[model samples]
Target: MNISGIDLAIIAAYFIAVAVIGVVVARRTRSGDDLFLAGRRLTWGAIGLSLFASNISSSTLVGLTGDAYRVGLAPSAYEWMAGLLLIVGAFTFFPFFLRSRISTIPEFLEKRFDARLRRYFSAITIFLAVVVDTAAGLYAGSLVAQVFIPDLNLSVFIVTLAIVGGLYTAAGGLAAVVYTDVLQAIILIAGTSAIAILTFGQFDFSWSAATQALPDGHLSIVRPADDPVLPWPGLLIGVPILGFYYWIMNQYIVQRVLGARNITEARRGAILAGLLKLTPLFIMMLPGAFAVSLLPGLDSPDKVFPTLIQEFLPVGLTGIVLAGLLSAILSSVDSALNSASTLLVLDFIEPLRGEKLTPRQGRRYGTLATLGFMLVAAVWAPLIQHFPGLFSYIQAMFAYIVSPVVGIFLVGFFWARGNAQGAFLALVSGHGVAALIFALVQSDIIELHFLYVSGLLFALSAVLCVLCSQRFGDAPTDAQTRDLTFSQRDLTPEETPAAWYADPRFQAAAVVALTLLTVIVFR
Candidate 1:
């Protein structure tokens, strides 16, 4: 846990360089478009890397390793299934998103349904992304910060994370977020990949040897139907539903895809993001699996990652990895801050004002919202330390909020018979189901796994949507329905790139195949 002067210097320099990038990009900000969607000019590569960076937060890096150490690889389904989900999004959701020419995902709801729906969706997104997800990131980062500097105050780390992430995000907006996220992605991958390699070396360079001390089913991707953590039914049903909500619809993630230059760029960007997702199974998850041998019997699974970095990695190398960990923190924090601001300004503020603000006014309101939300998240973050397990606590809350929304989003998009009344009831009933199940399960009155519980909630919501739509409401107006339904016309242009390898369809299909093959191999 002791930090060398070299490590201290490396970490300090990383922060300064990121701040400089924020300042430089702020000078280019001339409109709301530039702030929120990167002026809709990002290329596939930047978009892909930014998505990866924003998503692979400190919580994921630490929590995945920790979860694997304690409970085997059951939780990895959430990570791996996302690639398949992104493929689905690329083909289905992103087409609608791009064609709508909207800045926020909730705007799509407003266009298809009504402003009330938009505000409702946006409000939920802000609470989850800003309050829950952002606070979790801060808690995880501060947890790691304490490991690095035993003397560091938890509050200090939390506030520092907020100031660094919030200031840059508010100053330079999405363009700065994406560009810095790209840098964070590179550092994070390189640094973690090194640790993964070194971890295998601890077992004489043999995967078999590294996994020898693990629990049964520790390396398996598919668990039994009655598995305690991740039942096979849940893996099949719940994961995809949650994955769709996250990879396709979650504002924190989909915002990057929404910023791509065109349909071609967005599709390619999404595919590229899916490809990067595969790396975590090895770089993040396996390290903890191996740690069951290398660093055995740790007091808490959450401590496994830091223990590995502290013990095995040399000084300069540890510095790079530490920076990568902080990058993860900043990446998620800045992303959540920016997206939450967008939702507040575009969905609620502008609508309530009864007229659109000029670009300058929009930027000002967005900055204020970002700063305010950062304070709230920072204040609440350290409380997450009280949870039983970091990873499960985060995932469990998402199930309550995200599943119902996913049910409504998918139904609203695909089933023209679906109505606003149905959507409202489905959304409301979904959370009720989640709360009821959580209480029952926590009281030891139910044997259902959490993921299965999420699946149950999703199914209930979907059925409620159908029943209510059929009985309670009329069809969407022609104006709202136009170009809202899915069709062949939504695809990217048929013109082939000079190289077949460049085709989004080709790249995306390859990512999907690899994902399926991985699941089968691990199963």
Candidate 2:
């Protein structure tokens, strides 16, 4: 791929703009709450855009496009399923989360169950956020950077990207992450939309030309139960569970929602994110599908995204797309850095000390922690080359790990009888089941999709949560369940009545309808 001066200018401008935003926001970041939760002043639009941007990381772009090239559109289930699940979260989970005023997702566990669950889940979250999510994003960004600039070293690229993104995150906390994410989201959507249009234009923008040229099932979102990419049953079972954990429970993603000004803003932001989630199927995934004919015989599926940019995009547009890729890398890395540091300071440090830090102290520690995690992730990012593909490397672990966490959270929410002992036992026994299943599958003694494994693990955990709550402990007091449990208030409007069009239920319904329509069209 040849580089042009205009592309360099655009990419340079993006970097400078992000740095300025970080420094400016850092000046306003005065307290712990301001650092971790944006002083609880985020609006719906910022929350929505940040959620989408942080999630659609460089790894996501490369992995989704690559997987679509390798195994039809079945890989898109993870993308679109997020839309539907976000709607579910808007109505079911956001209310409790916002009402509780929890800084981290793990804090909610402590509120609902016990401190042990909080600390344990926080540890797990910190590991996944930094070691897996942040590191992989940096590695993926390096891969994309190398595509355009072949001489770029992996470690050098990783460190440069990390320092650029991390400096702002450490300085401004969640505000910087969200503000930068808003800019990144625009670049990402516009850049990918351009690539999609250019790819489709290759076949005179004919959908049939693109699909018919490929093998059967290439354009289909639904696949047979025996399909290797994503079986239909996994779509129904495993996808939702995974989506629930990522969109609703993950600290990095949920941190933006936690920053929203109010429940209405948070719910509205969730609906906006759901609508945005639908775009990847067309803009990102479909272009990869189109690449099956547009640029065939690639050495690897991972090359699909870069190859498309190299072959199809012109000078100025290439820079914008590359900037978008950079945007993705930074957004995911920064979100993870901020959220992981938040968990360490708020969830672990403060509690262990038996006293809350002053707001100034909190902000200072949070900044140091963000930079510390940033260094750790930068070191680990390049090490991913020793592992399998990025998508599988991340998703396989999540499949086994998230099911137990999701199980405990859902059980604790809906079932008032759920006790701390049951939640603990469920997590312990559930992971034991996961380990056994993982070994059996690895040894070829069993053949089950990871998604199916997720479903099975969830069932066992839920059952254990119920039984142990009954067998070992009494029901929690009404005081313990207050505002934390499921209730009519969760379903009700937070503010006074708004116009019909402004209602969250109405907006959610529209998003849901659009999501279902998308599935039907591609089914």
Candidate 3:
């Protein structure tokens, strides 16, 4: 893995540009809202790009490709299934959040249930975002840095990533993150696409040979009815629950949508993100499959992409690819930093103290919180090295935390009889069930993917909340009507400008291009 001077130069230039952009944006940020939520004025284009960039982290670029290298395209189920869920989110979930005009998702919980639920969710979200989510990003970034600069110590890599991501997030917040994300997304697409192209060329662009050489299960879009990864049955129930929670309710991801200028823009942004996600099969997953043919029996699956860069790409191109990897890492890290701080400052500190801090005061606290999380994440980054698969680890962590929260939100929004007490109890009990299952499985007391356990717990929580709410009290007359009014608003028109969705030219062109690419590759 001898990186050339040209590669280092290109990578250095990209980081300089990103840092400059962050500083420039910081100068324009007027308050905490502007910093954290982009002044709630982001257009559909910015939101859409930001969402795509934030979601496609180094974990996806490096880890997904590695998974594909080891297990084939099966892991792409996460990306492809997301498209269908995005449609559901655009129509079902977007309306309620937009109409309510709330800053944080936890705020909605408080309104729908009690402050206790809000506090619980807020604390959980912040801890996960800072400790788990941010740690993943930092760990991945450090791995990339280690490959690029092997002589550099791991602590240096951690500090470098933490400082760069922290400075930008603390200074400019979401506005800076979104702006840089757009640029980072472009770099990611171009860099990954270039690697894929070069890798395919090495195999003479032969899918026939590639598919034939791979294992029997590698090419199958549908996994076995009992497969652990896809598990045919799980797709019907498991994926939808996971996707809805991630794109719709998860604070780190949904925070991008919450920053949209209007409901229409948010919906459009979400739909576009779904569409963009469909590309992972080619860019991330396919590369890994191709890596199987090119770099067989590699000791670590996570090293696939870097190995490809070292083998196929020219000197300058290597720098560009590394820059893209850095972009992916920083985009996710900064987004987590900004969102975690927003949750801590808005949901927990202000409410607990009964103190109405001004936006400036909020910004000060937010900056401190962001730095605190960065320190915590830097510590946890090293632990991920012990995990078997990055993709599974990420998904499993979210399965326990996100499923119960989604269950509560759905019941609160749709079921009139879902009282605050029921919502609170269900959340606690659901989490308890998930924890018990996780402990049991780790200790060999039971055996199943945490996804299955989470799905069951989610169902139990939703059903119990509904039943308990009904048994305890009469449904308030205002509850059902208010819920319907909030849920049924025409989100498309309300959020988007008329031309946004009505303009069929872009969609048609994108469809045609994708069709052509699919035929060219798979044919």
Candidate 4:
């Protein structure tokens, strides 16, 4: 666990460089839009990198790797499935979101449903962002710091990481986050690939032996029909709903798309992100499997990646890997900080005060709010010691909250006959069902993975929204009608750019290549 001087120096250099970038960008951001959405001028490459980096947090590296260490490559079902879902998102969800020209996802809820739904979602998003998302980042970062600097107090590490994340996030907003994320993503990928390669070399074992040692079902990409993680039942009903909610509605992820320069760029960015997600198996999951061969019978699965870094990597390379881990942690934390601030200022504060603050006022409020939330998350980070599994805890909290929001958004956009009453009921009742189910599971009244619970809640909410809308019909108030009809029109050819795959030859080749790669890897 002893970190060398070179490793410490490399980590320090990355942090200092990021801080300088944030400070430099802060001076350029003049308005709330500039701060939050980067003046809506981010290119496809920046957006794509940001999306990839933000999603691949330390939780994915540390927690998912841990899961892989224990369960073999089965946990990678989430990462690999994300590639397919991103393609779905690019085609289906991107069109509507880009057309709406909305700043916040909750704003879309206000447009399609009602103000109450918007407010409720905003509140929930803030709570989750601060409690679950930010705290998780802090906890993971502190764990790494503790490993590298054992004598260093946990509280000091937690506070330092939170403040570093908060300062840059508050200063530069999404612009700095996205730009820095590109660099972080590169470091993370390179460092991970290096580790995986080195780990494999050290094993001096064949794939046959590794496969033999793995438990039955570990190598099965397609689980049994009733398997919990990728059950056949879930494919029929669960995955699409979960996909819609995560790719379309989740604020932390979708914020990157919202910052895209145009629909074409947004769609392209999403597709690119989907492609990038497929690499996690090689970088994170495979390394965990390699770890199983190297370091068996570890008490805590979460220690797998850190333990590997300490054992396998050379001195200078160890520092680089540590930097990559820290980058993953900070990238996610900063994104959460920026998005939570946007939701607080745009959705909650302005509405409550009944006064529109100037851009400067908004920026001030956002900075202060970001700092406050960081403090809260720092306090909450240590509490994760009580949780059994990081991935389970993360998923369980989201299952109850994300479904209703997802349902309301889908109904609002696709179902023209949808009404506010249905939206309200669907959101409230969907969460209610999810909560009750969760309580039952906690009390041992039932057995289900949180993903199953999330899928069920999502389906129930969508059905309820459709049924209730049909029953109530349109009771559109003047404001509701005006908002619904306002700026609603099909984009002309001039307005809508060409699709990402408009080139027929390139599109065909990409599809073939991706399909072949997927089949070969899984086979």
TM-scores for every candidate against the unseen true structure: 0.97, 0.98, 0.93, 0.92
For residues 1-523, write the lDDT of model 2, one tens digit per residue.
Answer: 6789899999999999998999999999999999999999999999999999999999899988988898888888888899988998888788778888888999989989999999989998999999898999999889887887899888998998899888999999999999999999999999999999999999998877878889888888999999887999999999999899999999989998899999999999999999999999999999998898877888999899998999899999999999999999999999999999999999989998899999999999998999999999999998899886777789778999889999999999998889999999999899898989889987889888899999999989999999999999778999998888898778877865558899888999999999899999999
| Model 2, CA-based lDDT | 0.91
Q: For each candidate in the order shown, give its overall lDDT on alpha carbons.
A: 0.86, 0.91, 0.79, 0.78
Better of 1 and 2 by TM-score: 2
Report the poorest 10 consecutive residues by lDDT, candidate 3.
Answer: 503-512
Clashes of 2: 0
Model 3 ranges with Cα > 4 A deviation: 386-389, 477-486, 495-523
Per-residue CA lDDT of model 4 for 252-352, tens digit only, reads 88888888887667766776777787788878887787677688889888889988888889998998888998899898899888889999999988888
Model 3 per-residue lDDT at 94: 72
Q: How accurate is candidate 4 locally (lDDT)?
A: 0.78
Task: Give lDDT tens digits, candidate 3, residues 368-393.
Answer: 98899888888888878888656667
Model 1 residue 425 CA deviation (Å) reads 2.2
Residue-by-residue lDDT tens digits, candidate 1, 1-523: 6789998888888888898899999999878888888888999899889989999999889988998887777788887788888887888879788888888989887777667778888988999887778999999888877887889999888998898899999998899999999989998998899899888888889867887778888989888887877888888988888788888878898888888888888888888888999989889998988898777768888888898899889888788899999999999999999999999999989988999989999899988999999999999887887887676677788877788887877788888878888888787888887888888878889867667777888888888988888888787776667787777766655357998887777888899899989898888
Model 2 alpha-carbon miss at residue 440, Å: 2.5
Better of 1 and 3 by TM-score: 1
On a 0 to 100 scale, what is the lDDT of residue 274 in model 4?
A: 72
Candidate 3's TM-score reads: 0.93
Error of 2 at 52 (Å): 0.4
